[model samples]
Target: MSNEDQYGGGVGSGYGEVGGTGQTRTRLPDAPSDPYGTPRRAPRASRGLVTVVGVVVLLIAAIAFANQSSDSPRTPADQTPPAATSTSATGTRPVDGKNGAIPKGFAHDEQGAQSAAANYAVALVSADILKPQMRRQIVRQVFVADKVSELEARLDQAYGKTFLDQAGLDANGNAAQGLTYISRTVPVGTKAAKNSESTTTVDVWCTGVFGTAGVGSTNPVSNDWFTMTLTLRWAENDWKVESFAQKDGPAPVHTDRTASTAEEIAKAATEFGGFTYAR
Candidate 1:
């Protein structure tokens, strides 16, 4: 998506503070001093003052102790199972891959959930899927059986002829000579929206580079930030994507790394094969 599409919008009137009405109330007269006013010796005021001071000190100490405990790092043993592991944190058991390549089992713990989300996001946006055969394999491996056909058809339609041409790829999806096609997604973090013993909904925030890098190519590598939210179901003892959606950015400040020449960028893309990510 273009930058304008990603962030352009108007401010709303709600941004301003609301005005408050001014009102005042008269103070009530002090209660008449105790009726048994037989010169009741100021009820030992110093003793009450001491008690109040002591209570305040105890409260401060208690607050400090609580803060210290909160700040301390919790070990695995100290943590509950769900909070300790991503798979468990997500509350979904890992599934066994139907074949190789598809994630068959994921841990029902935090770490496992994060790993699953990261790996799945990588696979979803990789350049490997541009190849016809590989694309089918990927869809089958990543999606549930019921979703496979629909996702495949949708993806095929989305990555149509015009899209391929704009990306500097041929009709069959191969990059033109001297050009390199790049479609890489790296997850910065994963967050769980809802997790349970059998299901997990996670959003993976990612940064990626896409398009072609080559001299005189219309398309050039550009950076993008997006969040891919995946809803996973536990089946066959593993987690599989039930559904997914993408939205742009929780983007960070851009770095100062100098942009490389097209030739250098193209060469790097050619030399470096992409990885299958894990958290």
Candidate 2:
């Protein structure tokens, strides 16, 4: 925490030997001596030297121990823990199948809630929602059992025959001649503001292409961005949409690229497939 040289000879006789003779003679004014003649004071310097050497060895050992500790790998207790990266990719795959055309059966977690919200956003804005037949199917597929009746009535009034006629669709929701009506949404991202075992609230940012894409089309294809917020419930062992609403975006500034021809736009919409989004 934080070694010694010995003097070879002991203090011998304080008397000097008479030269060339085997006689020991005591010189006058001789060095001090005890009755026992112990050499106590002479060894005092050598003991002090040994004490200093031992202290120096201890100091060196302490320094070496500190250096070793600093160079060694740190244990888990020595480091700060990482934070949860919620906005990052979750690595969980999205739901694979759809109930007819609408997405169904999401996971019972935050990611699942987000997936359900995003797919619901796409379904609600689709052209199919304008037709009575397809709209009924969409309501049944996307909304929960408790919400279906009320939502069906509200949606029916919202997309009534008058609105369909104004948009160049017949009562059966068929487009006018030489026109292919388009209303498709693509989700940019999803966020879960509140999540629990029974309920979840998610928001989906989306960019949608709406109107018609064909020759002599009065309502030309155009893009708009918006955000859809959905309240979801955990039921039937999966996430199901309970309620949803939309607001105008969070949209990016428009680019000045030349618009594609109606034929090209129609062809592209037909060829390009939509994605199954994950968090």
Top-TM-score candidate index? 2
What TM-score does candidate 2 get on C-alpha atoms? 0.68
TM-score of each: 0.62, 0.68
The residue-by-residue lDDT of candidate 1 on 16-123, one tens digit each, is 000000000000001111100000000112323343223222222221111111112212232334554543233344444435564546676655666676676666
Best by lDDT: 2
Worst 10 residues of 1 by lDDT: 20-29
lDDT of each: 0.43, 0.48
For candidate 2, give the lDDT of residue 251. Answer: 71
Q: Once model 2 is optimally superposed onto the true structure by TM-score, how far is the C-alpha of residue 6 displaced, in angstroms?
A: 99
Clashes in model 2: which pairs? none
lDDT of 2 by residue, 111-177 (tens): 8888887776666555665567886787677766776676556445434464454455688667887
Task: Candidate 2: list runs displaced more than 4 Å.
Answer: 1-84
